[model samples]
Target: MADDAQGATTPVLPPERRTAGQEHVPGNVLVSIGALLLGMLLAALDQTIVSTALPTIVSDLGGLEHLSWVVTAYMLAATAATPLWGKLGDQYGRKRLFQAAIVIFLIGSALCGLAQNMPELIGFRALQGLGGGGLMVLSMAIVGDLVPPRDRGRYQGLFGAVFGATSVLGPLLGGLFTEHLSWRWVFYINLPVGAVALVVIATVLRLPPKRTRHVIDYLGTFLIASVATCLVLVASLGGTTWDWGSPQIIGLAVLGAVLTVVFVMVERRAAEPVLPLKLFRIRTFTLSAVISFIVGFAMFGAMTFLPTFLQVVHGISPTMSGVHMLPMVIGLLLASTASGQIVSRTGRWKVFPIAGTGVTALGLLLLAHLDEHSSTTEMSGFFFVFGLGLGLVMQVLVLIVQNAVGYEDLGVATSGATFFRSIGASFGVAVFGSVFSNRLADQLTDAFRGVRLPSGVSADSLAADPRGIQSLPSSLRPDVLHAYASAITDVFLYAAPVAVVGFVLAWFLREDRLRASVTTPDVTETLASNPVERTSYDEVCRALSVLGSREGRREIYRTITERAGYDLRPATSWLLLRIKRYGSVEPAVLAERGPVPLTVIIEAARQVEERHLATRAGLDLSLTPQGEEVAERLSRAREDSLAQLLGDWWGPDRPTDLVQLVKELNGELCGSEREQPYDGGPAQRFA
Candidate 1:
């Protein structure tokens, strides 16, 4: 995080941590970038790896009937536990939890690979998912800890590919195992990969414990987890063994609904609620969460059927099916990485999510029309477009939500977002599964109307079973194939409408310009409004949303100065963002990973002081009454500019466009330079 703009020295954290601006380290930035990237990879991999294996797993274990449960179990376990992990990580530390997740996932992976049956496999997959949940969340939370949102795009880009890539790789590996080896190898693969990630994280990642003392909200956790589990189960079971109208299904739905209401009530009274209810107050966070659920709905609805269509209808081997999955992976990687760079350079994020979702909706339209006879190229094209949309929205939403809330609430915001997406995915699977199964069963009954059926074939067995497609006789197989293909197409047709809903949600995302100079003090002031919450290296080179600016650290400093009264309390995180962003303007990102050294910031400050441009007394970060007074003055000045600049842009919600405009202006060569000097007049002494 670069505290200095284009080599111009400044403590960027606002409110309290405004630096009298002393402290510096000449080197120690490159290492931090590496760590962030690693953390990101872990999350994306977990998400993608299981997609291709479902078919092989279902067929091999004689559990095609319970295939949905495999995916559902993972989604439920991971999402239900997300808030708990994020809150604990914030309370204790990020790196600690990040490492812990890797270990947990490793164990679960081994168990999944070793399972003797589908029932056993599902249990292990749930364990793996519990650990996997922490990977995505902790990485995002840690990025908030060290990098500011404005310049996070570049680093986000580097790590963003993993999200799309994992989606592709997961299928490919699953296919490989299903075709050439056992499908269980898909889970086993995590062992070696997790080991490599663990090594990088252990050596390179670092985070100090927060000084605050707070208790974990046990009751709130139980309520949230119970509600989440119930919703997930209802979604997973609705169309399969249980009817939407069945008492079992309805009761699950009702119980989950009631539990969710109870969770809201309990949180209001808890001292340290797992969910930061206050984050919903922010327009960005609210909109982002809504849209995230839509994205998940659209994505899962389509993905849930692709493998089965390939195996059951097209007769493609699982491994070849994985090969066919590459188009989407390529598309996701291209869009996500490109979008990340675009956002970083421009500091505009709103448009990406909107456009991404819109694109996804269009892709779904194409898939909805697909049949088994469609050419491979045509199918791949649909997947590619779908993948691109997913890529654009995935990381961007996390960054947007994190930026919308206070530092302490970073974990809560991320966890909340993740939980919703997980829930949405489960919901999509359930709703569409019911629709597909009903359609397929009807089609099957009609196709076989005049033909004599085999001895054990029964409608009750077919409707109650997830594996009915695999049981048709060769004479009736063609009919079943046609039904399966039509059912899948129908599922995507419904998914298209779900995506359209997300597009509507995206339409409302509010775009805000990032402040070029954020003092640490500013984030602390956020604590004044939000008393609620808020690590990692891995595979420490890919996942932390790395920003190339120290501005957030400056804001954090400002917040501290405003709340607790201090300017530029010693920290190494500020250097990470600043150096990562402008350091390229200065030099390449360092290869090592960790927080930038505090002395580096001090020395950089010393360099400024020696140059004789800025003075110390007014500029230095300290806890005296005068510092607080200065903070009030600075806050008002910044707010005044917000009014002046934002006043002219009145019309539709141009969130993405607005952010881009601000990012460009803050950089050295562009837009807002002429007016920038207006706000900092005597504020130059601090520089």
Candidate 2:
């Protein structure tokens, strides 16, 4: 019957059940865990490792002139490649794609270390980012493949910790390499780490392959990358390299804006779009990714300025500035590790990110109080506090993203999240970094005028080196000091509003948990194509939940699905109520009256499926010749077990030990016996 209200075209599931691969799938899941974790390590490592080395990279390559481009190149490459990697993972199997990414990253890292100039480094870094981007997106997408979301609690937490550890470790290693070894060694470091990750992933990650048709959105990718590169270039370089009104800068900015509009139009019409606009219909997925972008923007934007502020405003050396970042890093490590373990134990994770974002915003707000007079101790407290917030949210959101979508969509869904965050971070660094520099220059000029400084001093030169201000002739030093102090303070104050934007976005964030993994791609539509009655336990649950919207109906459906997969009919009303609510019970010694317990069906199913009995479809409750014999034997055993359990609770005079007596009693009462009367008199009915 077509159910018009439910849009009755709803497909009924067939009798066959589903799984990740097939029966005894846990072994496959266990094997997959390593590959997923390896991918996670690769993804998380890319973000943090590059972040830590950027300053040293700027110094060694003499690319402060093109400093923002270094990070932008990676962001552009990763964001552009994110969707493609996802589609490929879905088509070719997750394990193979993950291993390839690790190998590719290793190759890129090796080349990155050999680069002689900024352009070469940028090109190599872009390649590395393309590979690293796959790491995060695919790791999460594979998790969707292996684990049913309902049981994904522990894995999500483990993933979160993997990401957190990478973030904290990136800076620590970056500082160590830059201080004690050649700056080029920072890029060199990924080679060894990536080799190890690759080895672990290759030996353990196994997968099943079935190819599906998919087309790459090459034009869309090109347009998106071009727009991002141009926009970021203009945002990061405007007023510094080229005046805001200059023809070259204006032309690039306008071109980027126009390309962005074209990308949207092309995506809308493409046969196989990189980012399907339809995915936004999923409320949880859409909202969570938005929040992720906001968080990434604030986190990436702030980290850039924090070190600069320490060095420029507080007169701290580069190594010392890195050291000062320790409290925040430590806070992130402890919070993320602890929260992940806790989420695994409790199977509850949504609240942590929500709360953490709120607190993080508060910490950023407090940190905004920094000025030249702000003590290092005060700064440490703020960093640690904010780091605590970061630790709570970052990795958890990715888990949430993975959980909200289906398995086939996992690659694209996860990459979509990574893409948004990448885009947001690029936007943040370009915009905020530029604003900070502009304010610093402006303050330096104003301060010099108030104190009558010599006209020859360049404000930028003074601002660039804290010592440069103090080294100035005494007649000009006081004004230089005031300008440096005020400029740095203005940057922090300006940064406050950006943190507020993140805080508000957090308020609307959705925290969805994992659901059951879809064994088949597009199960909803595929099953609907042959809409009929249910076949599997999951199908039954889905049907009842959707069709029976009245209060308590879902509970009935769920109860039946869990206890009896198919043979789910009730006996006595008492037993029926139990099965409808609390689910099946074990065979017992003393269910002497009332009805049969649910497990009778379980035993029946086991016997029938194992060929001890025959339960052919559409047989109208008639057992086959062999089934008749098996059912009789089962009835006898069930009677005995029930008698034993009910020995004290039921009638003391009832036969409690003999299987024959139970068989006779059930045969007489159930109309199975040839000699049974139509009904027992009132008192016997109770028995």
Candidate 3:
């Protein structure tokens, strides 16, 4: 009796919490998503908004030497803090932690706008990055919590759209603010939008306390943060601030390597590790991380030189260059949105990253052939293909990792994937910067060979100020422009092979069917329900949808019969369980509940009665004493079959909620038509 009571209580969650983000509270979903997107936009915008404002900032602050740190500090802090924030959200609660991130970001943003010098600006930006990291990862984790994998595509796609939008808009907005207002407005602009998002989230995004003992992994945090900071500094500073072989660069590299080794050891021993090493064992998790990293490496690495190419070779203004980037932006938005809808509807996704990487390589190869004579239209076309490839790879890769893990690992898993991509982006920028700078210098030296009469002008001066290339003598200007174009082509040539590596890695991705619910689809309804309202009954119907086709029914039958070690048709077992449920119900009533035909019901009854498993008088049906024992065993058998099918929950024992979820999911097998496979086979791949 005590055990039974404990079982009953286990299903009841502390108190039902409702939020717009939770599926159960569906009304507030749009508002909640809007708020989440607002936060995402702020983080993404910050990464780019400072780009066009940098010159103005440098002039005002008089710190040209420390210019790169403006961006590097943010990236370094954001990358290091990502995993830690995720782990904390898992322990303390995502809602409060997310809100805290917003506040921190706001504080940093406000301070950034007020900074009088480069050091203060970099410090405030780092502070902002701490919060920005949390905002990004937590928003994604929240989506995973709210939406099932199958339905997540559209939301993730929207996020991709936001990212793409910000990429183009950030520079334009930054330039406008710097020219028309103050350079500081670039940071200050986040204030009103962030305040609105904060208010919306606080009001609409409620979640139950999922707190536990906060065994903060202080050592792991310190080690990983040190490693991230050191690596980012090396990437941002090497070959520019210091030579690649300089002691400063070498020291940072050695420090990063040692810190990484210590981080791994610390994680192995830490309770509630920041990034669980066990996740690496999952093929999807590990593979997705690699693919994400490579995508970032190739994409960010090569794309860094695009604006310079346009300004020097094509003579486009900064604003015009931003405008000319439209082709890539349009392609990305279309590909991401379309692919998401297709995946949500069809549930087949493995083909995307494979094809995306292939296209990315193709795009880079074509770009390697670009020269001084390349038309703007031709350049736009290449960018479109590259953008499409990135679009297809980015959102879906996260979905794959999220689908592979259990619920408890969602936050860490999402954050870890983002972290790898960020690290890749940092390294890509550095490596590509070094390659492009060296090649450009070599090309200019050759172009300027044996030339004279350009008084007070040098190759280095033209390289720094691309605008000055046009202002030089027409005879010399063409040589400089051609040299700039040739060097950029070499950068693309170098980046193409990296993308091919991603293509090869994508082939190993194991395609698993996306799950229909945030948690596994089970029949157990954890919450108390009104049988009359039939919410549980609806869930059962949804689960039955999985078994609507002949293939699904066959799998279930095969599973059950294999356990029985004999051909035990579902009719007999189902009838016995039904009899137990209704307590001697009329035959018509039993048939109605099962939606069983009269003839099939009669046949099952006769077979059970013959075996002394059930008996019937007139229209009424009852389980015989022997039938009760047989039914109990069959029920346990059903549970075992379900456990095998649904995948295991993450605890010592399966929760009663899962039992209820599975039971609720087993709604009467409505004869719904099986959905046919989508005939459009990887159209997004071609885009």
Candidate 4:
């Protein structure tokens, strides 16, 4: 029982808690998860897949001026629509919404493939983004419906791994599709994959009906979206499309300011604000938000421009550019995984962001030195350093924000933190584009001055079509390449100071005792995918489930047995708990459900019978009176262990709803005789 993040003040019991004697495990959990993963892959892959394709897209569409909007439009729509998707899914059900999202995404993808112009493609990308946001939020939320809290962590990691794999594969796949086929294939590829996911989800997925009453913050969502649009317009179009002092630019800046003020006022009164005003009051949340924003700004801005440099300045093919970018991806993955493990072990995390920001600043400076003549070794080293810095900071921000807020605030706080980062990415790409455009124009004019151009060849033409440089007289080509190199590296030089700001901000972050539930790093969160919509209860459950998973199954039973003051083997304790929950268990059925061998289960059964803890009737085993007492003790010990993991939240003044949730989760953890907790893999077995 916990407040739904959307707006429910009262706790609504989960379906399993409300139902009397039965639990609501999905009929085919793995199949349902497979469908969900596919949905997630669609969203995650889209974020990166388009980056490598953008250069080709702009060249084919003949609008280098509108290049950034291709990425920005999708991000803007997705960020604005994310919170609404979560609320709607909670009110209705996720199954229909998830399917609807897939349909919308596929339609947009089709439209984008068929687009004949840049404006048309940008518009279609926004439409795709609308559905993409739902796919991301709902996929994670639906996992809570199908899996119990104790096993949720094991499955959640799969989602994280999907994000990680997509981050690497997306660019490579995009390059492949664009090179071997047409650039349109980048959008077209989502069709077959999405269709399969749609069919599988419609067939295999199921969930209990949910009809929760919650207030949707319509005005607040609109105001924020309007504000983001105004700012992005000013950044993308101010200098290039309109004069900085032009009415269009000034009006947009003013409108953005007015919208920000109105958004704050609307959020103060709305029942369920898109982003709660109260959270900004928390120092840790505020600082984390700022730092997350800066991280996104630097990270995405560089990612957007680096490919342009590789493709234009270095004259690399799209496929080869993606291959060249692998060092950065590897660095990010290795650093994030390592930092997460270290934090989980030491419970000390303040050092990472500080080091991360400092190294990120250094990396940006290093990238600023790239030119047409820079070696592959030099470029790879700089890219790796930048990724390492990002990996260090990105994952820890979510952890600190979640650790800082109360349970009621946890859901909003987590989403809010990522929301700022998303917003920053929009700003970063726009601003980077603006700077590159303006600087490129000046560099081209300067390079072309005092030089005779062939008929119809001009600085403007060269700026718009990078491929045009190859046809230019050889003497003119170096100037064009240098213009591009300087323009791109200047973006990085400008961004380095932003990372420094984050590094300074890291100094003020107060390190609190890390929560047991949040100790394990979720790869999806670290990658900064769309903000997942979850309630306070669901958030805690995920963290705890992940923690429980980190402590292996055999280790968990062994610890519980010791805490319960029993000297029995871990397998015996597991058997007793199983019998107590299900009334009776057949050893053969238990063995079949388990990774543990038939021999191990039979040995456990024999030990219990020898100890007078169980009596056998045919193949079914029943606990004795003494065994019943021991089982109750083990159950309490399990509950106590879970509570202890909560740290301060389990104090004497703990809320009644939280207590109920803990008990409900405990019952679910021990409920199903056929289902066992995920213990890493099938190779793991109880001793």
* Local distance difference test values of all predictions, in order: 0.59, 0.56, 0.65, 0.83
Q: Taking the candidates one at a time, how many backbone clashes does each contain? A: 121, 15, 18, 0
Per-residue lDDT of model 1, residues 1-687, tens digit only = 333223322124322331121112112434655654554555455555566777666656665555666776777677666666766786677778888988888899899889888889889888987787777567655654454333344444444455545556667777777678777777777777678778866775554444334677878878877886786677667766787799999999899889989999988888877776887889888887788777776667566668878777788887888788778767766776677557656778888888888889888888887886889989999989998888777657765765565434554675567556766776776566667767777776777788887788765454444356567777777776777788778888878877778778887887776432211111111101011123111111121112223233455434433543334432322322232222111101121122234455565445433433223444332222443344344334333332233333312553453444334323321111111211123332212
- Top candidate, metric lDDT: 4
Candidate 2 local lDDT, 1-687, one digit each (tens): 111121211111111323324332344465467656765665565665555566556545644445555666766777777667767876787678887888887788788888887889889888987887677567755654454322233354466567556655766666667667866676777776677667766665555554556776888878888887897888878887789999989999899989989998998999877666766887767776676666666667667667656765666755577778878878866776566556544546768766777777777777767777788899999999988887677556655655666533554665566566667777767776677667667777776655544565567655443445556787766566556555545544665565566556656656544332211111111101011111122221222222222112223333332433334222221222222111122223113221233365445344444553333333112245654443344334433432342233235453332333333333222211111111223222211
User: If candidate 3 were superposed on the true structure by all CA atoms, what would the RMSD be?
Assistant: 11.6
Candidate 2, TM-score vs. the true structure? 0.63
For model 2 the local lDDT of residue 565 reads: 31
Residue 505 local lDDT, model 2: 63
Q: What's the residue-level lDDT of 281 in candidate 2? A: 80
Runs in model 4 lying further than 4 Å from the true structure: 1-26, 552-559, 566-571, 585-611, 616-621, 651-657, 671-687
Clashing residue pairs for model 4: none
Tens digits of per-residue lDDT, candidate 4, 180-272, equal: 999999989899999999999988787877557789998999999999899999999999999999999999999999999999999999999
Ranking by lDDT: 4, 3, 1, 2
Segments in model 2 whose C-alpha atoms lie over 4 Å from true places: 1-42, 92-96, 115-117, 139-157, 197-206, 279-290, 311-323, 329-361, 388-418, 443-489, 502-687
TM-score for all predictions? 0.67, 0.63, 0.67, 0.91
Better model by lDDT: candidate 1 vs candidate 2: 1
Which number leads on TM-score? 4
